[model samples]
Target: MSESAQAADPVAYIQHHLTNWSTSQPKSIADFNVLHLDVIIFSALLGGLLIFIAKKIGENLSLDNPSKLQSVAEMVVEFVNDQIKNVFPHPDKLIGPLALTVFVWVLAMNAMDLLPVDLLPSLWTGILGLFGADPSHVYLKVVPTTNLDTTLGLALCVFVLILAYNFKSKGPMGYLKMFLFHPFGKFFIPVNIVMTTIEELAKPLSLGLRLFGNLFAGELVFLLIALLTLGAGFSFGLFIWFPMQVLLDLAWLLFHLLVITLQAFIFMVLTIVYLGMADATADDH
Candidate 1:
């Protein structure tokens, strides 16, 4: 948006910043066919970068004199392992690595929000403009966690893992039996089925919505703060608004560092807890 237009319509400016660079405009809120190319691209890129860093760290392991990067990587791994041990005490080889991956990947994705809101989007707009695209039509949202599809996709994977762990620990018949008679006797089978199903489904819904809501609200706050100085030119208003903008932005950035890290840790811990529940046998219950 041009300076004059952005100043004139702060709503439009915020909306433009929030819009995703998608394959096509969504028809409705429930439309699942639309592809958010920006979310997919940024998510994949972050995941690939994480894998590369991990591989390099693994290759250059030094016991006597470890690099700072290696030291930090080891600390993260050890922290995740300790968390897994607390919840998933069993010697399941998969849970440790899975928890670590989820924590690091989600942390990386959330960290993207730390970038200046207009940085990537503006850069992408300029690149597209060089290729004859209209600047006004270009849309890009860098933070993948702000996208519901991305958050839900991560939750759905955890949901699938929950089911798989249940099946592995309790056989197919045992799994069915638990759903049919859980938290109630066989006499109340219908109620038990309904309650158990809802309980299972709520796991993913809560997981996905919690992460998405927090990050989406954070993104909106950043946009609103940016709007504070939208129209402030070399006038006296610039002197007043500019300092407030910088102060607010810096304060938020500091707090959001905790938010992003906490969200990632919550996601990881909850995944471990859910899997722990799934691994419980009938006797344990």
Candidate 2:
């Protein structure tokens, strides 16, 4: 009935956190649509944090010895800027901020996984229930990348950037010419168009899947570790289970930290690469 009651049942605690705030019925295996509010809220908050951090950087910048914060910010800025500079070639006044945002925002969002997974969700859910809403519907997965909706939304944003840069760097005719003639003869225009379309479609798919799959699996592994403390102890014996469960959770979490960083980097780098591709010139080919 209450959290104290739920605390008496480990199975229910983890199960409640894992449950989705979905509208669909579980008719089959495919009936899963994890209504992940944590991902959305975390992403937006991180995005806002990125902008604020950027503003602070801009306000406090100096040529003398930099503060630790400024140095860290500069390192991230330069890293993203170097990647964009290498790929895009055009020194646009606008693209720099967007690219920097991608790098920082994603890094922040991915960093959420470093928090004790259930702590924030448990806190927020309790807070929500105080407002008279159903706490179950406040479903949260702290790692935004764990949700298909968030990752796909991010990938789609990158896709839109590609389109924007395509239009900005290449006129309508140039963009069309890219689809019609880049890889082969003009006679193969139709096939080329279809191939190019598929390639474009694959960008978001790859981006989304790469991030989503990694984080989702990582989350599941943690859930599995949580399960380890369950029936194994009650059915077998506590002596045989608790030690292995602690070791396994620690090891899995340590490994997942690397994975979360790698996935975030991969996603950001892909975004920059796609943006760079959009800004490519006909002469380069």
Candidate 3:
């Protein structure tokens, strides 16, 4: 939209910032075919960046005198490993690395919220405009965790791991039996099946929604704060509102650093707990 138009409509400004740059226009709000390009791009970039950093750090390993980056990396690995040991004492070889990746990746994506809301999107819009694309049509949301598709995609991966662990711990027949005779035993098979199904489904649902809701709300607050200077011209309002806007943004940014880290930790821990539960045999249960 034109600057004046956006200034006149605060809702449009907020909506423009919230919308994701996608491969195609969605038919409805929940169109599966509508691929969110921004989320995929940012997520892949962040993952690749992490892998690159790890590889570089590994190649430069020096026990005699570790670099600051290497020291930080070791601390993160130890922290994640400690969390895994707490939940799954006999965790699989993959669990430690997986938990570390999830925590770091989620934390990195969540950290995108700390960026100025208009920075990347505005830069992207300018680049697209140079290529003859309409500036108004350019919507780039940097934080992947704020997108439901990204969060649910991560949750579904955990769900698959849960299923795999269950099948490995118990044979197929034993896993099936869990659905049939869980709480009340085979006497209440029907009720048991229904209850077990809901319980199983809720794991991924909760994981995805919890992460998405928190990040989305945090992003929304940043956007709302951005709106404070929306139409503030070179008048008395600009001086009054701009300082307040800066103060609010700084306060929220400090608090959100904790929120992002905690959210990542929560997700990683729950993943470990669920996988640990899946490893339990019928007798253990």
Candidate 4:
């Protein structure tokens, strides 16, 4: 969208904001070719930030007197450990790091929501302008979780872990038996297969869709609030609209902080639980 178009139509502005900075504009149904460059970039940067912080904390280990950062990091590690212990009886060494990474990386992605919607977009526009590109064509969405692909990708990783743990705990024959008999019995092998496949697919779908749905809705709400507040200046009843926008936006921001944290924690816990379930044996039950 051009500057004049955005200025002339708020709807167009919102549409532009919702679009991702894709490698190319999708044209046909087979255009699985679209890549959300913005989502991948932000996700990678946030993941790198988490790794860097973890490395720094490991290097500065202390017993006598820990810095505030170390104290906070310890609390996070302890919290994740506790969660794993509660949910996963046979957590491997990787589970701790995986849980921590998921929690922190997701929390970082969610934190991007707290940024002003226009701030990054405006800055990106300016940067593109410097590079002699049409600023309007440069779409950038800072929140990775808001993109379905990002959430689904994370869920798929968890799904793979679940499969691995299942195979490890239950041998190949045992794993095959799980799908063939356990849920229904040998007589209902076909039904069991169908049901088991659905169940397996549902895990990742729910994990991904739940996170994506919540964050996407939150993002949309924030965008609506931005439109409300920003559009107030041009609305007919400016006096009333402006004040209401401020109150609502502020209220929503406070409420959304809780939402962002809870969503990240929920995603992490679910991943842990799913893996735990995979690792469970009939004897344990």
Candidate lDDT values, in order? 0.90, 0.74, 0.92, 0.88
lDDT of 1: 0.90
lDDT of 4 by residue, 135-188 (tens): 678888999999888899899999999899889989888889989996899999
**Candidates, ranked, lDDT:** 3, 1, 4, 2
Q: Per-candidate TM vs. native?
A: 0.96, 0.79, 0.97, 0.93
Compare the candidates by TM-score and give the number of the best one.
Answer: 3
Pick out the ten consecutive residues of candidate 3 with the lowest summed lDDT. 276-285
Model 3 clashing residue pairs (backbone): none
Q: lDDT at 109 for candidate 2?
A: 72
Clash-forming residue pairs, model 1:
none
Scanning candidate 2 in windows of ten residues, the lowest lDDT window is: 29-38
lDDT of 3 at 91: 46
Tell me how candidate 3 scores on lDDT: 0.92
Error of 1 at 86 (Å): 0.6
Give candidate 2's error at residue 128 in angstroms. Answer: 5.3
